[model samples]
Target: MIPQNIVKQNILDAIAVIHKEGVPKERESTKYHLWYNGGLYPPKYVISVANRFANGHALSRDRFNGGAETNNFLKRLGFEVIEETLATKNEMQMSEEQTFRVGEYYSRNDIYQKLNVPKAKQKGHWNTGYTQYEKDSFIFANVGTAGRTGHDHPNRFDGNDLIWYGRNKSTLTQSSIQSLINPEGRTYIFAREDSNDPKFLFLGNGRAKDYFDESPVKIIWSFDNETENHPEILAEEVNELEIYTEGSVKKVSVNVYERNPIARKKCIEHYGLGCQVCGFNFVNIYGIIGENFIHVHHLKPLHEISEKYEIDPVEDLRPICPNCHAMLHKRKPAYSIEELKRIIKDKVTDTPH
Candidate 1:
C-alpha cells in the first residue's frame, strides 16, 4: 500500500533494490513506465518495491493498483510518469521461475494467495496442489506440534533422517505417503523448525526412505540439499492463511517431483533390485511387498546439469537402498558410491564384535 506522500530518496532506494534482487518475473511491466533520471521503471511495481523505504516492507500486488491511482500519486511527488515501449522493459534482468528459496522464511498466505500455490487442506500431512514453475507440487509442514489426540509426534531427526508422522489415522498408502515413492515427482519441504515461528524455512527437498502403518503414518524422510531459491525481492510481512500457535496448528501439504523415469527403469534392469552399496535386497527382506523396491540414484545429480543431458543407464545410474541413498546425498555434490561403501566398511571394521 502506498502512503499519502513519499520523499524522492525512497524511490532511488527502490531502484537500487531492484538492481540487486532483480524484479519478480510476473510483476514486470511491458508498456507503462515512470521516467527517472533517463531510466524507465514499472509504475506500480516501483511503489511495490519502494514500500521497503516508505512503509517498512513490500506489499503484494493485490493491495494496490497501477493505472491512474499509483501513477498520479508518484506524479504528485513531482516524478515524471511516461509511456514506454515494450522493448524498454528488457533492460532489467527478470528473476527466473523459482520457488520458496531455501533458508528464506514464508507464511501460509504467501504460499497460497501470493504465489498461487494451492492450499494444503490437511492439518499436518497435507496435499498442496501443483506449483507453476515446475510440474511437481510444493508441500509444506509446520513442525514441532503434537496432535490434538494427545499423541506426541514432534517429527524428530534420527541421525540425518527425519521421522515424520502423517495426519491422524493416515496410512502408508495415502497420496501424501505415496509421494515419497512416486518417481515422477519429488517433495520440497517448507517447514518451521519451531511450531510457533510465524514463517517456515525452506528446509530442502525430501524423498521416501521407509514407512510404517496407520492412525498416523510413520515415514522416514531422507532430505537432500537440492532446492531452488526464490528471489529475495518481496516485502516480508506477517500475512497468513493458516497459523501455527502453541498447542494447535492449521497446516497444509502438496506432492511433486521431476526425474527421468525411463533412465531409472534401465538402471534397475542393469543393476537389479538390490542396494549397490550394502546389497540389501528388498524382496529378500520384506518378500512380495518389497518386490522391485529401490531408489535409482543418478551418478550425475540433476542440479549439477545445466544443459540437456542424455542419461546413460550404465554410466550415470545405480540402484541404491533408501537408507544408503540418503547418506549419499547428505552433503553438497553428494558422496560417490565407492566413498559411501568405504565409509560403511571403515565403520564396520572399527566396531568391536
Candidate 2:
C-alpha cells in the first residue's frame, strides 16, 4: 500500500526530477500512463519516484504490483490513468493495444510490432522514407535531418513546421502521397537528434499546410498538437570561427545542438513575426510562403555561454529579420536591441554624426 503521506505534489516533483536526469526510454510505458498537466507519463515510474518523496529511498519495483493496484491507487488520489493519448476533434481514439503517446519515443520496429501493422501494407524498405501502416489509417514518415541523409529529400524542421520531401523518383499520385493528402486519414512524422539514436519522437499528428514541386514532392506539415524539444537539434547558423581542412578528409565527426522550438514559438507569440529592430515583417512582404519566417536572436550569445540556464523567451529573445539579425552580429558579443534600434532610426532620418 502507498503511504498516505504521498500526495499529488510529490508525483509532480518526481516528474521534474526525471526530466532533468533524462527520462529513461526503457522504462516508458507502451500502454498505461498517468495523464497530468497535458503530458503523458509512465505510471509505474511515477509511483517509484513518488516513493522517494514519501520515503528517503525509492520503492523497489518488486514491492508493488502493476495494472489494477497501481491504476486504482492513482485513481484514489484523483489522478487519471489512460491508455496512450487522448483523442480530439471527434470521438476518435486509439485503443490500449495500438495508441502511442505524442512525446513518447519508440523505434520503427517497436512501433510496428506494438500496433500489429500488417506485413503486406508496410510502405517499403527502411531507406524508402515513409512506412504506410494502412491497417490503422496512418502513415509514419521516418525523416532525416539536413545533411545526415544527404540533400536528396531531406526532411527538416523549420520552427513549428516540418519541411518533408517525398521519396525521390516518385510522383504525387503514389500511395504514400495519397495517404498524406487524404483528409479521411492521418500522418505522423518522426525524427531523432542524431543518426545513432534508435528511437524517434512521435512529433505529432500533422495536417498538410502547403505543398509544391514534383518528382520528389515537397510538403510542409503543421502540427496543432503539443510539441517537445530535442536539445541537440540546433538552428541553422554559419560557423565562421571553426578551423577547416578543406581537401583531404580523415575520419568525419559532427556535433549539433538544436534551438528549442517551443522557446522560439513563445518569443514569436509574445513579439509577433515583425522584426524588433527594423520593423520588417516577412509575411507582409512575401505572402503565405513567408508566414512565420522571422529569425530569433538571443540576447546572450549561445556559443559564449558554457552552462545550462533556463531561457525566458519573451525576456531573453526577440524576433528579427535575417538582415537585422546579421547586422546585430557584425561585432563580438552582438549589438543590443536598443543600439540596433537607434542605429536604424538614425539611418532612416539621415542624422548620422
Candidate 3:
C-alpha cells in the first residue's frame, strides 16, 4: 500500500514532468511515463493515460498492464477517459465517439489531431474545426498567453474578446475563413497554465462568430457568448485551485450551457441578414450564396450576470456580422450597438475612400 503523502508527492512530481513533455505518445521515449497515475501501459492499438494512482517506485513494464482496478479508479476520479487509435500514413481514421469525447477537455489543435478531422487541402495549414456534426456541440480553447505557455498577461477575456490564434505565417485563404466563422461551430474554453497538474480546467462554451487578420500572418477567430456563465471559470487565480488528487477534483466541473437557440434564431430572423451596427449583410452582397448568415450577439455579457435571467430576443439579442460583433465587445462593459454604429460612421467619414 502507498502512503498518502508519497502518493501526493509522486503525483506532483509526475505533473511537473508532463508539464514539460506533454502526455506521452506511444513508442516515444518512455521517460515521461511518470505522469500516468497508474503503472504505464505498453504501446498498444490505442494509447491512453489513466489517472489511477500507484507507487512511483513500482511503475515498470510488468506492473503496467491496466485492468479492472485501474478502470474503477478512473471512474471514481471523474476523469474523462479516452482511447484513440494511431493515425496511419496517408489515411486518418477516427470514430464519432472520439470526436464528441475530445472537446470535453482538449485544446483546438489537440482535438484536430486527436479526432483525425479532414486536414487542410493546402500544406503548412490545418483545418482546426470539423465539417461533421457531433452528438454533443462543443470545442475546446486554452486561454492565457499566446500559446498557453505563460502568465495570464494576454487573456482574451482581458481584451474583452474570445480569441483563437492561427498558424504563424500561414496565408489566410477563403477556406480558412469559412472553417473558423461557420455559424454551426461552438467552443468550450479551458483555463490552462504553464504549470498545472491536470493541465486543463473546464471554463465554458460559446459560438465562433467572426475572424480577423491581426497581421498578414496571424488569424484571430472571435466567438460570442451565447449561454455561457464564465465568471467562476475566469475568476480563478492561476494555480490557486489545486487538482492534486481525486478529492480535490471539485475545483473543476462539467459545465454545459443551456443555450437559447430559439432566441438566436429569432434575432437573426427579425434583423434580416445584415449586421445591425455595420449594416453588412452576407446575402444581399454575396447573392443567394450567403443567404441566412448572420451572427447573433447577446447584449449583456455572461460574466456580469450571476443569476438566471430571461432572454428577450428583441431587446437582449441582435443580429450582427463578425466584425461588428467583435467591436461591440472591445470594451469592458461593451459598447452598445448605437455607440458602435456611431464609431463606424466616424471611421468611414474620416477615411479618404
Highest TM-score scorer: 2
Supply the global lDDT for candidate 1.
Answer: 0.58
Span of 10 residues, lowest total lDDT, candidate 2: 88-97
lDDT of 1 by residue, 52-156 (tens): 787788767788877888878887876666554342333222212335444445666655554564444422323331122233545455444543345456565
TM-score ranking, best first: 2, 1, 3
Q: Which residue pairs in candidate 2 have backbone atoms (N, alpha carbon, C) closer than 3 angstroms, thus clashing?
A: 232-258, 233-258, 234-257, 234-258, 234-259
lDDT of 3: 0.42
lDDT per residue for candidate 2 within 1-353, as digits (tens), equals 66668788888888778756755787777666665533557788888898998787887777887788887888787666665323311112221222564545668776767767676644355445565554323433443433235543556666556777776666677766767766554576665545556676666667788887577888888665323222222233122113234443333212111234545656776887678998887544543224346777888766756755556778888888878878988887788989988998878799655
Reference-based lDDT, each prediction = 0.58, 0.62, 0.42
Model 3 lDDT at residue 284 = 35
* Candidate 1, position 333, lDDT: 83
State, as a TM-score between 0 and 1, how close model 2 is to the true structure.
Answer: 0.42
Native-structure RMSD, model 3: 22.3
lDDT (tens digit, per residue) of candidate 3 on 1-353: 11223333344444455545554454343211111321232221112221233432434434434444333333343322223223211111121222332113344455556556555622122222223233233322333333423323233332223455544333356444344445345544444433233334334444444455553223343323323322222223233324444345434221122123334444655765568887786533542223344666778767756665556668778877867866877787889999988887898899996
Q: What is the C-alpha RMSD of each candidate to the true structure, in Å?
A: 21.5, 16.2, 22.3
**How do the predictions measure up, each by TM-score?**
0.36, 0.42, 0.28
- Please provide the root mean square deviation of candidate 1 (C-alpha atoms, Å): 21.5
